[model samples]
Target chain A: MIEKILLLTVAVLLSGCVNLHVHFPDAADKTAGGEVPTRPADAGGAAK
Target chain B: MLLRTAVLLLLLAPLAGSAAQITLSLGSLRHPSFEAEGVMLSFDAARLGEADIRLGVLRVAGTEYRALKIHCSGFYFDGRRLDCPEGSVRREDERGRDRPALPFSLAWRAEDNFLSFSMHDVDAVAFSPLVKRLRSWQPKGTIDFGLTVEGDRAWLGLAVRDLEFASREGDVSGKAILLTVAAGAEHRGGAWQWNARLDWSQGELYRAPWRREAGVIMEAAGSLSETTLQVGLVRLDVMGTGSVNASLAWDRARGEATEWGFVTERLDLASAMDEWVQPWLGTLDFPKWYAAGHARFSAEWKAGGLRRFYAGLEDARVADGTGYVELGGVNAQIPWEASSPTDAEISVAAGRLGDLPLGGFALPLRLDGSEATVKGLSAPMLDGRFVIDLLRLAKRPSGWHGEFEGGIEGVSMPKLSRALKLPIMAGSLTARVPRIAYEDDVLRLDGALAIEVFDGGIIVHQLRLMDPFGKERRFIAEVTARNLDLGMLTRTFAFGSIEGRFDADLHDLEMQNWQPLRFDARIASSEGDYPRSLSIGALKDITALGETGQPKALERVPERSGFSFGYDRIGLSCALRNGVCLLDGVAREGEGVVLMRGSGIPSVSIIGYNRHIDWEALVARFREVIAGRPGAIIE
Candidate 1:
């Protein structure tokens, strides 16, 4: 049981180590660590 | 026999002089007259069919008498013939002061070596407003006969420099400073050499109506023909503040079907160059060359509805917080080809709004259609699709409809307070509306808005609004601000800060008599639910209300959620646009019912003050405040 608990802890630690690879259009990559703004598809509201 | 020979020699001597000999070089030229070393110089005499000059060149300090002023008849063409000394010039200085010669007529002269002519009383143009403004005017300058060759195939070239004159209206009172003018020209031909060229002291005029200073460069070139004349290249920096790079070309054919075409690099529905140059359109017949910077094409012209006014604008950056009506700058871009008024298409890119000093703001706009009409007035409506807190309308209209798309980052509550010209809770917002409509000058937005306020600031995550005008009165929205620093909002508007949180909305607001009236808004600052020195200072700039308490140990206390909010005296007031707001009532304190009704735009004044209320019972009172009515009191 103690070994199992140790394995679970290691798995949790490794999960945070997972690197996320993201690609974006040139315009969206203007700055690092920032989200690009996007316009609404139409003037209609979401409910419509 | 000797006497008869002498008479015959004298008679035959004059006949040998038609050899087009070199004449005296005229020294200098002044108004009404100039001196020629050889024959008398005059444009008036030349106009009488064919002018003739009789003189000789002062070569080696000698005059052989070879040039002839044959009149092909008149001898000495007096200055009166050319109306030189007697010629009166018109003035371009005053508005309706009865000064006629604004665009003076061109004058000229001819001689053996040098000839000169002068043009005075040239009209100086003035733009609109207090600054220098002038009507239509022709550039005024002089032409000098630099080097004149006479071999029937003679060539005439004038240095054409240092030609000084005014191109702007002269103020009668002041030493009418005119548009500084300087230019030069040259021409060569046999029977008739047509030559004229003009250049400016400045490079070019590219400024908008909102811009203070402007400059422009214009050039026109063409050979004179008895019939079927051709129009050369001409350009007008239409916006006075934008680019006038279009290419307009046309050709004249003989064997048949009159062919003409035009093209452009970037075509706008309402052309900036065309509008500026249209005044001169009637003066000269030119095939519309809308595209001056790019392309090669041409089309026929036709007339349509409301040619002049194509777009209606609502610019409000000038008077932040003033309900819609007080527009700062107005511009209308009509759907007309740069060169041709008919049979052409124009496109509108984006326009910036906030740059006007009166209401400085930046708004980049894009137009969708080539044509749009407001109340039957057709104009090139700009496809506006930009984010808010960026730009604004220039003209405050009775009604409006617009849609633009752009992004505004990092807009804070304090800035919004200053822009809206009012007080509010602190927060930041990043918002965009697909469309915004204003009818009767009331703003109606049809879109969605998402916001997050952290650290005493209103933050916008995403906001979209637009109104197409359909069922479901849609809704005019306003956010409720709580626990905000009223001081920040006031200072941004240059009105100083007040202390309070505003839980109020103008409720689909608009201007009535230039005043923005709020039907309901319940506000209560911990330190002031009533009239405080801060509120009074913000409104009337008076520091005679409420106490100025000294800072307590809690002054350094960090913002804590548990220490969230505390109630104080409640107060309300009627808002006025631009500036001014009437108190809804006298400063009221404690637990009291604030009655509101549709009474003459609603009035406010403090009635009484109360203290010590049961915590459980006060919840109902809070609901009452939202309803703008006296709530149930179990005091």
Candidate 2:
């Protein structure tokens, strides 16, 4: 059991960790009511 | 059949009638003999001479008695050989008349007695030693297997003492050849009695990887259906001296159908000890030894530190020394709900008892069900209950809290004290309907309540109190069931403890918050739930209310120095925040009257029975309020 714990510690110290998530805002606004708004996805040319 | 009976009677009557020849059990008698019961014989003479020895029935198969190529010779108890056989069967005076007849096959020479040896099919391991001593070859070459008979009247038995057999199977000692094999009767429909016992001890053998120092004993006797039981205890030898003893007894019918659906199945490998390394061999785990009628049943098992209460699958798992619990996820059908292991969750139920800790104590918990994952953590879902120390509160203050929830169900609120071996508290109240929840600083509830306050405690029936974080702010309640003893209730509070009772509506009453600013409540203990169906003032004042028409204590204990309350029962819908209370547009001074004007004093007062205050109209005003809204104005 102690061996397993030691191995886990070694693995953690050797590598790095990651965070949960990051956020960004969208293009829609009340002032732009009814207007066709461009999106980041469209600018990347993936829109069909 | 008639021919066989006549032959058997003819052959056995002579030996049976002779007192010198005795028939013994299969396990007795070391050598072969004629009077032997079934097939067991003992040679006990000491001389060099030939005696005509009678041989028992030697049959290759039923109805087929075959003459055995017998081997008769003499040997001392020290395993020394004396002059006996030049060859196997007897030869005609050296004339080669019996080249293969086993010289003196039926004739005893010297001290050895003539023994029978029939050439019937025999297991190689059993006779390999004898064949090797004779320098016999393998395959078709083998020793005597005695005879083979077919009948339930008798059984085949063999006994050999101080027998060792293991040829040089490649440079290894006879110890390596040690193995266990058994040859017992497979009776068709009869009982077999056995007093078999075996002991395995550690201090008695060679060195090995696993130290197995233990003893086992077993005895059994029964028919094909019913079996008598026998058991034994053994010590586990680990670390040279550690040991664990065990014992069991069972006597029942073994079959396909029984009461409660009992069936046999393999025990879970995950639960088997010696399968995984345990943490803290003796302290934290509680392992169990269980016996059940069939598979798919629940059993409480503790291993070291872990424990679980589980609803066993038909076969998978059962009692986990801890317990199998889930909050709102899967076991929603269970009467008591447990929200999976949270840093915290709250509940408001009818039970006077809330988990273990009454109010805000530490509670460590685990959750289990079909959907077990505790959400984001990669750790395995806690499958059983774990302890949470209330003392750990300092560490996870905001993350863990147990707020009582739901209706108290069939829980008698009166025995809440007796049942828990707690301080005596009495009263039993029921709710028409109720529900409550607590978590992350919030507790919400709704329901009707009829309770009794007898002796000195309060009993509630329909009740609801919600404390949802700081958002909902405070809680307000109203109950109207049966008996309620106000003095007993003060003891129920975990606070420093306060005690008293009144006959009027108690507007602000609270438990579990920081301040004494209680929740607004509109409650009337009429149907004998309360001692006096009271809420307004104590007996000291009640006397004044009926006589001088005023709160008698109003003239006694001054009200918080600068504030005084003259009204015994007042509207509760007025301004209420934190601790400060307001009545109509006016405020109060410590005495029992409203301050039509202001006092230079800063702190508000909580008036109790006291002098230095008006006592007449205060009692009359109480009468007016009772005639009007009686038990109105609640949150």
Candidate 3:
């Protein structure tokens, strides 16, 4: 009886999760095409 | 005819000489509608009555125009046209800073009152004098611009292909900005009316001030008429994830009163927070949390501050870096205006809070003054619902204060254990709380919550949290459990089988950074008429209880080989303070405490000799025993 109830609750919870999606992808993947142009020396204080 | 030509040539000789010399000086030179001072013109005469003209330094409106050289092939006035065939202007300010020369030709037709100058490859470096007055702004790179004036109307156009701007002590920079502006203005009735179009493209604002480069593009059109400036429309794109459309109008005659509105659609929350929010919250410490959603924002301002604001969110999700707290399907519509009342409903569909699965909760909220009232909400918990009554929250000068009343009814304990990542236990858990309040960064509960498990009742009281959101969180509580079946607790933890009832109390219990701070706790066998049985495994572990002893304290105990015993009672206690546990038991004989007292056949008793033990080491021993990794016992 306990196992049945546990299975039922799990089913309900899983069914409600149809819309859930992992929103954060890898940062490196999102920035893939090298969009930022190289800063000139006058742009100042580039990271060493 | 011969007599007439001789007479005309003689009369024109001196006038031709003066035109060839072309020298003039005036303390004040006045045109029909304009005036100037200290004007001087000089040039060299040519044999055929042409000249090379030089206009010297002159002062007008506090700005000085330096010498200008021009070559005039023909310098005579004809039908209101004074034309210069070829010329070049050396741009300079009063301080004599030289810029590159722009070669051009000029013509002025006074009959139509139009002046047109055409030049090729002009540089805007001469505008540095005007840009120097702005704070923390510098323009670097080349710009090409042009100007044309016709009567009282003027037209100016400028464009720059790439430029770099930096701020924040040179740590923040933006590059490769394509900018263009075209404007036309006409002066009439002592006021100017103008319209302009501005375009910016392929721009990226970069580095330290931001964690990464943020790309941007914008296009806008605006007009200025009389004392009112109107912005027709502005379209902006950010990070390829969102777009904004906005418009504004400001009345300068009325203390710059402004009305503006904007709509930003479908902005990725993670990038938005990283680009626009985190830099301002540099002092706060929190785990890396990611979010995604669409948020619509609008606001109105007058008299230099906010008058009304609204925000709407849809399909929003926020999660911590550790994957512990994730929420989905968050939606809300909130509106606030000065001294006005508003109400909203926030809902979440399904997600996990810490380790507990949470779903289908809606909170109805009403705000007035600086206080908000939450009119209860229910969330699914295991097989039941956790319900909260009306909660009140008020913002004060220090932080935020809030209070609520809630309880859980018949939540499945075994599943809850799994959610809480705890040892599995039987039965169910239920709780009732009269009140919980938060103020000055502390959360306090005045009443007790009861958990029904192990066929027992555990009551918790005086629960409090200090710095609940800080790096080091603390939980303080006192608890008492009565008539607990020891067999259930032992079996749940797999700590060997024991059949009996017991009672326990924990007083002044405090946990800081998730470790015990100070507590006086005791557990003893309860008085009952029930069969008391202990397995050999239980006897061995119990016999190992000593201040510094390992889990397998007595390796060769009498009941080591699958033997069982019947015990009359057992008791243990510890006064944990200052990182140490002062050990005690039901009785003390000699220098040791008798932890267990045996009564019948195969009876066994255990004694602990040491009194003071490191709390952490003692906990490690308990964990090892439960993990079935008890080390060798001492002789």
Candidate 4:
């Protein structure tokens, strides 16, 4: 069961990376745009 | 033109024949690539002599340096060329403090617009403007660099020491970095063809899930156009890790990689997982994993998605740090393509999941896009064979979903029980799980799982598990067991001996994290014409289950030659809710419940006076009974 979960997690993580859209923080204004990239909403749960 | 004007003005200066002092001042000078304001120069014209030059502001390649000063003790000039053989450059801080001077050399030829400059031990922060153009991180350290430009070609050599940098968001950061970079570029066809090499020997870096700690070298050849950057090949070698060869095409305007692919040399799986993969699993409630062996991996990304991926594992072994799961002697070749179906195979020598030891098995798999399928996968499981006739899984935007049909056959009950740390039991268990499905984070059984054991059958119905791998995992099911021999059950559990057959019904059973939360449970002697008897020890244990200080009928029974009694029937019921159980027995007798009724001579009735008991307390008493500490007396 754990092996299966690990495999599923790898697949999901890869898919998530494929769809990732990076937003670089604005260099001119440090406080204006310094947010970590958003993670998928459903990424919190175990891979079912 | 600016250099010509300065030279012309110096030639017209008064010369004292043998050694003449010449000073030239320009309010401002400008060129396509360079600009300076309030420039001043003083030097001897007859021979090589001391020279001092200062500029209020100097701009080169879109970067500005203010309050810059250069002192050359051996400056020479001839017709159309100028040289600063030995010099030092300094910049005044905002508070008017002169920074430490850095040694430099300069040579220029106005004949063909050729220039060369080198500086050593220069503060890396002074080059923030150039670094900012490439990334938003702020750098601090020292650098030694040289640049040469002739026509439309340029060469650069840079070495940075003790560099520390971080982006404002902290997603990218490095510390104590020591590296050397050499790059060259030539303009051709309105673009720059560039090749570069970098050797990094020290530093720890964090760019989200990618971290590096020293010993890395990268060599790349690429072209940069106005809207795109293309790398023909990039070879990255990481010390003590592995190497990767890749190519990429990036759209500058879109700030995205249009296409990229990489193939890794056989990589050490243990190190790779710790360095690159663990961070992606941040804070997850998963067992830490340790891996061994080597694997080759390749992947391609195109059109903004992963197009293909392949992995070949060579005798790999992965184990859970918590000792719950392990796979040893595993080898597999897995290939997945977005546009086509592929076949893969994997073999394992031995494995374990929790307490169940697994035997070697090989499986064939098929992959197509986001779906995977397996047919007829079987493995030896604790004296039985676990067989999955078919398994299918698909990845959807909503999440992952899957289903499988499997069964456990001829598994020894004693072995299973011992493996699971349960009491030793007789007989073997066989179960047929028709279908199990997973969707929306829930795993459910479509049909019942019937396990035959102890000359009886246990049927589990309506089984559902929520968030099976999450912190708040929950399991719900209804179970029924028929005609289980009480003699075997008692002996197995170390409970006081009892004879006859019994049936149990457990409805609406709910458990969170494997702890019972709520249930309606009933156990009764099977209705049959059979001898029913309970040992004196069992009677004491049953009576002890009543509420503390509650009087029980078993106290009146006198000692007899045979330390046992005959009972007509036995029954008990408990409906649990909110940590409490509403208890009942076969029939109510006055203020008590008839747990056992007398049947023959010397028989005694057993009654329970408590109708409400704490569930935990009841379980504690049951454990005590099973452990042979009856905690009750009959005098």
Best by TM-score: 4
Q: What docking class should model 3 receive?
A: incorrect
Top-down TM-score ranking? 4, 3, 1, 2
Candidate 4 Cα lDDT to native: 0.74
lDDT of 2 by residue, B1-635 (tens): 22342344345544533334332223211222222213322332333222222234332211222222223454211121123332243222333333334332222222333232243323333332222232222222222323222232223333222222323342211121112212233334444322222322212222221222223222222222235332233222223222323333334434221211111133332332332222222232223322221122122222222122223222222222222212221111111113333232222111111232222212222243211212211111111112221111111344433433223333454444444444444444333233343445444444434444544233332233443322234544432222334445433432112232322233334533323343333322223221222212332233333323443333343333223222222111122233222222122334332212212122112222222112223434344433423222211
**Model 4 lDDT per residue over B337-410, tens place:** 99999999899999997789999999779999999999898899998987888899998898788998878789
Q: Pick the candidate with the highest lDDT.
A: 4
Q: What is the lDDT of residue B568 in candidate 4?
A: 78
Question: Which runs in model 1 stand beyond 4 Å of their true positions?
Answer: A1-48, B1-222, B231-369, B372-435, B438-443, B446-545, B548-635
Q: Could you tell me the lDDT of residue B358 within candidate 4?
A: 90
lDDT for residue B525 in candidate 3, whole number 0-100: 81
Comparing candidate 3 with candidate 4, which one achieves the higher TM-score? 4
Q: Say which docking band candidate 2 falls in.
A: incorrect
Q: What DockQ does predicted model 4 obtain?
A: 0.01
Clashes in model 4: which pairs? none
Looking at model 1, residue B277 earns an lDDT score of 40
Model 2, clash count? 110
RMSDs, each prediction? 21.8, 27.6, 16.3, 17.0
Give per-residue lDDT, candidate 2, residue B501: 37
Q: Is the docking of candidate 1 incorrect, acceptable, medium or high quality?
A: incorrect
TM-score of each: 0.32, 0.21, 0.65, 0.72
- Residue B570 in model 1: shift from native, Å? 6.0
